[model samples]
Target: MELKSNWSKTGRISQNLLALTLLLLPLVFLLLVVLLPLWTMLQQTDPESYHMVWQDDFMRRQLGWTTIQAGISTFITLLLGVPVAWFITRIQFRGREWVLRLIMLPFVMPTLVAAMGILALFGAQGMLWRGWDDTPYLLLYGNVFFNLPVMVRAAYQGLCQVPANRLYAAQTLGANIWQRFVRVEWPQMRPWLSGAMCLVFIYCFSGFGLALLLGGERYGTLEVQIYQLIAYELDMAQAGVLVVWALSITLIAGLLYAVISKRTTFKATVQVLPPKTPSAGQKLGLALALVLLLLCCAMPILALGWRAISAGSSWQVLLEEDTWQALFNTIRFTVLAMALALLLGFCHAALAHRWAWVRSITFLPFMASPVCVSFGLLLCYPDYTASLSMLIATYALLAYPFITKDVLAAWDSLPVQYEQAARTLGAKNWQVLLFVTLPLLRPALQRGLALAAATCVGEFAATLFLSRPEWQTLTTLIYHYLGIAGQDNYDRAMVLTLILMLVAILIFSLLEWCTARKEKSLC
Candidate 1:
């Protein structure tokens, strides 16, 4: 008995050491790749850098405009998204699934492609705003288009958590629709709304591709200004200042989201009743909302497709050697990055399940902007900034947070008995992980890989910052063509956007399939 007790103690010690090692591995990688570089950049920055940026009227205006536009975008998203969320959750509507899918397009669509699609619909030469393009409007349009789904999804999830019994009880107690919503539903939804608002604001404030492509020089955001400083002016100090400023805001917002999300627990899962059929007034409201939402979300993409179809010999553009090379590079980078992300995230999630603080470290990369991350890497590894290896590392670092979140959730949801049962059979830790934990994590890992790959494919800012000429991906090529003059260049850009969209759609379809299968298995 004493010998057995000693053996158990020794096993516990070994497991603790293993857990510590797992946590430290990713933490050290993050330090080297993200925090260390950022520290190096900070060392190079001086008060002069901050003074120079602050004194520059253009920089000041850019900062102001970034905040203003982000606020506007968040407000607009809530306005449009909340009603749609209510409709989707509260009303029985035909084609609801299709509408949800339409809303998801922007989630997987590359920002650069979305920018091109916006231009295709609203540029000076576009279908809607011919000869009169407004940059701010276009930027706002892009922000709303991309972020609306986030708000809607969050709101819908929150609404779904409301207890059907409580709602019906309220109705039976002489509560009207508005009263029930205001008293019960509103309270539950507020936390989700706040969280979504924070996310939308951050996304809009950190707008890089949209601001660069649509806002132009006249309406640069902090992100665009930083890009210009690093890529164009080679002003690391100014870029560093901008990074600090942007990250400070991001950190604060992230903390707020963390607090809100923590407090935003739902009641126990209950059977959700079928939604009521809409009245005529509700029908008119839903129609108006759907039309407006469709126009905002679909018009640009449809317009881009039409432009691609109409552009003569556009199909030949895909045959170009550079285009093919970009495609190859994108695929290669995505595969390598996805693999790295999955490995790191799986380990991180496993450790995080035991030690929750590891999550705080992983979340930093998610909150930090891609441009800032790449800039830090550039400052640290100037010679390797354009290296394929460096690009893969950067993509993996950016994507790992998403993977970690998904995998960690899955890890936490799993019962502890599986591992205990494996141990009871005298299986070792590594064997249990391989034979039990990993197989159970397959669905989450698959989802994470798909999301990470989709993100890597659409990623432009970091890729643009880090890539050499030979390292350019399809997105950078599209940016190249869009910057040049001529109808041919525009056509090529549209065709590339279409191609990227198709790839994203394929990945998303796979994700949906995996999710459906998981749900079926659960049922």
Candidate 2:
């Protein structure tokens, strides 16, 4: 008995040590990577700079347009995504699952790829429309293309939470389909969908790549303006003020999203009704969904492929030594950043399981724009801004939250009894975690890793800001081509964008396959 007590005491000490390590590591990383840099940025800013920045008419217009464009995008996305989500969730049809999967394609697509797709279809030399010169329209289309999936997925998840029994009860009370939805479904979905709309607004408002590419000289948002101020004007004070304003706007949106998201609940066992075949009238609604999906999701990718095939001599860009070096850099940086993200995320999730507040730290990156993060890095680590380490660390900071969020969700859903049983069997804390927790956590880790990998690969704004000429990634390469004049360079940029898209897709597929293989092994 004394031996067992001593062993348990030793185990407790070791477990405490492990917990402290996990807790401190991620916090330290955040302190250096996010907090300290942001603090430095704040220190460099004052009311005088803010006043000077706001005095500029261009700055004020950009801020107003940023808000206006985000509002428009959110309204349009909700207008399209909700009905489509309702159609997919409430009505059964052929290829329904395929449509659901198709929505996810946009989530994996890089912003640069989406921009290329739009330019291919609607630019001055566009395949479909040759005279579409309205930059705001182009920017709006890009925003919808990227954000509609978020709204659709959110609505679908929300709609699933509506109890079928309640709907049936409403129907029995003589409520029509519309009436039933208004009375029984809308309330359940409102919080979830509202939260998603906030996210869409945040993304659209702070988007850098689309605004930079599509906004031309006139329609750029605060993010693009910040980039221009830093990169072109070399106006750090103005950029810092813009960063403060951008952060303030996004932070408010993020808090609202959090509050709305908290009101939503996922049941351990939801009583979902099997979908029924659509009626003739419902088929019209389904057709609208099909049209929206094609316009918003499929158009960009189809356009990319169409343009890539025609990019004949531009394909020679693939043979350049510079292209090869950029490709190598992209792959190496993604691998390194992904490893760092996994480590940070793993520690974060472990700590978050013990203290719920720890989960909030991961959301900081989401609230702050990538441009802001890069600029902060520039200020805090001036000498290291051009180094590979700074760039990779920036990538990890943005990417790790996906892993943390996924792992935390998995941790939350885990049964406590299994861990308790191991403890009762005289298993040390580390032994239980290694043998029991890690296995169950594998699926979540894989999902997070896939997302983190994709994020690192597609990262553009930070890379653009922090990367030196010698350290150019594929995204930076694409941007370089875009900056140069001539049809050949434009075509080359499209080709490079296609390559980046494929890399992201391949990473997602490989991780997903690993997850499936792991599941099979467990079975």
Candidate 3:
């Protein structure tokens, strides 16, 4: 018994040391990679840069248009997303799960790939709008296509919390479907809708690839303009000014979203009836909405696939050595990024679990633009801009918040009884974590890793900002092909887009399958 007590004491010391190390490592990394760089950029920025941006008509217009476009996109998404959410949550239908999953495609797809797919479907040679010159329309379409799912998922989850008994009571009181929804359902869903709109607005506003590709010069967002300033104009001070402005806007929006999200709490468990079958009018409404959503979400992907197959000799591009090298580099970077993300996420989540204040540090990156982050890193370490290590670090840092969020959610969901039981059985803290806690967190870890990998695979802004010509990923290659004039180049870009989509889908599926298998084994 004395020996066991001594062993436990030693284990406690070792575990404390490990926890401290884990906590400090990520904090130091963020300081060096994220905070320090931004500080350096800020110090170097000319105060007059802000004045210049304010005085420039084009800059003011760009800021105005950015907010306008995001607002428009949010409105459109909510307009379309609410009905679909209601259908999925309140009404029964075949293939419902598949439809929900299909909407998630854009979430995993890289922005560059999504942009390319959109171009393929609406560009000069596009089937629907061949020879059209409507850049704003295209940009709006792309934003909606990508951001609609966020609203749909949030609204669906919120609507699911509505009690069936309340609805039944309303029905017995002669309240019609519309009346029940307006009186009982809308109140519960309002907070979620507001939060979702804020999130979608931020996403669309800060979007780099889609704004760059689809918005063109006439319709550039502040993010696109910042990238152009740094990459094309080499105007670091101006970029710094824009970064400050953009970060301020995003931070305010993020704070609003947090406040709204905090108020969206529901009961942990609610007794709800099974979804009701739709009446004929309801059925028709759902069918129409589903079809419209499919066209917006799936048609671009189908068009890309169709173009890849139909464009003869475009397949020959894959035979080139450079193409293969880019593909290999992409996979390598993605794997390394995902691994680093998982490690950092684990450390951050562990620390946050012990001390909730640590969670605030993880959100700092979300408020800053990726373009700004990459450019800040470049400014601080000019010599390492082209380095593979830099690329991996950029991807990992950008994805760290997402991984941390997932892991933290899963950690919070776990019951404390398991750890207590392990402790009662003479298990040390490290042993409890390694054997009891981590095993239970496998599903979340896998999900986080998969998401990080997919994000890295499609990451273009940071990659483009830091990568050298020799270190081009598939995304850069697609950018190159699209910049050149020719049907053949466009077709090749389409093919590469298809490849990226397939790769992302495969990773998502594999991780989900592994998580499912692990859960089944435990059961």
Candidate 4:
């Protein structure tokens, strides 16, 4: 029997209307949160304005710069990230588990905070190399500093599904290492590679804080230009133009990705053998590991903790009344957004389990950028004044893709055998779900929640746009400090950043511990 909630007006209306309402829920939010604002911007523009912005020499030059920088960043991140991802996943190391944790360290930090880490490592005041006296080759280095880990981690996990037996069989057939990989591994992993590349490209294109903080805005991407227009020139028209271009490119890429992703979604059924231990003779591997650790983790720690701490931080920054207020707002928005995301993810996973078409359709919003999402929200609700409630709702809509995709990924991993076993015991569907399936899915649920929280905590771009003056959060506070400008402001930014990160990591760790407890309890 299909259970209907009392909230539905009538049973028949409930049947059709509830389905309609539920179907429209994500759409309504997406429309109001993303599409409406976009339309508003489009409506405000004249064809002439579009032509002017598109034709302006400054805009054109910057657009060219954006393209060139994104291209370089994408290539370099891939070059470095792919190798690191491969090394970590395919080999055993002294601290592989720790390295995985370190890899995830980036996602927890706000983009600005991450850029700060990179800056401390390689900036103008970079402790190791103070001089920016590098050739053209090093231009990509700063962007790649943040982007590489993103690509490597995505690709490594996705590519791990390649069957080891197949690779072994090819090697036994007189194939050398490179030949074996080409013949046996590359074919199956192309989809994951493509997906990883697409993700990396989108991130590099949209990246703002990193380009500003690390690259010093000399190499501006779409995001930097959008910020420059809005903050510096006070020009909405130019901001609108850059935003629309970003939207067009991102949406097109997203649609292509959806088509590609749909094909590989079925490959979820494939399982791999337990990993064989990595062999010795890894001098090359150790060198690589040390370099990555230093660049990604070690330098940042020294820079932020060592230099910034003494330079200006007092207890006043951490305990300021405004700091506490920002913390509260951050927590409130994160929780509210996470709750909505959880609901949407639950519905999508349930629906996708039965229908592939609905699965594909729900995925379109996943590709939408924060700019587009916020723009849509701005349009759909022209009455939308900046309030805590509305901002949280917008954040929720922004988080839906991450929630839905992560949950769906986890859902796809579950086998039907457990449910079948429950059914054979004469359990009904609801009983089977309540007693059997939910328990099995606890880990994925927890993991999704952790990622969602982490994402919300670090989220800056959309929030920056949506935020009213009163809705200051940690990342916003950091931006506020940046706006004030100077060496003195760094400590304030770092203090809030460090606090924000600690909260996120605490939540993630607790969730993980709970997951482990469930496993032991089940065993």
**Which number leads on TM-score?**
2
Q: Tens digits of per-residue lDDT for model 1 on 83-181?
A: 888888788889887776556677668898788888888887788876436458889999988888889888887888788998999999999888998
> Which ten contiguous residues of candidate 2 have the minimum total lDDT?
259-268
lDDT for 320 in candidate 4 is: 83
Which digits, one per residue and each the tens of the lDDT, describe model 3 over residues 1-523? 9999999999888878877887778888899888889888888788767777668999889888998998999999999999988887777899886776566677778898788778878887786776544569889999988988888888987887788899899999999989999999999889989988888988888899999888987998999988988888998888889888887788888777756755565453566657888999989988988887887788877877888888788988889998998898889889888888888998988887787567656566666778988988988888787788888899999787778876776787687889999999999778998999999888878877777788888889998888888888899998999999998998888888888888888988788779768878988
TM-score of each prediction: 0.91, 0.94, 0.93, 0.87
lDDT of each: 0.82, 0.86, 0.83, 0.67
Clashes of each: 0, 0, 0, 13
Tens digits of per-residue lDDT for model 4 on 255-310? 66666665455355556544446556454775686587567545565566654556
Error of 3 at 60 (Å): 0.6
lDDT by residue (tens digit), candidate 2, 293-385: 998888988898878878999999999999999999989999999989999999988887887666556577788889998999999998786
Q: For candidate 2, what is the TM-score?
A: 0.94
User: What local lDDT score does residue 411 receive in model 3, on the 0 to 100 scale?
Assistant: 83
Residue 32, model 4: lDDT of: 59
Ranking of models by TM-score: 2, 3, 1, 4
Worst 10 residues of 4 by lDDT: 133-142
Better of 2 and 3 by TM-score: 2
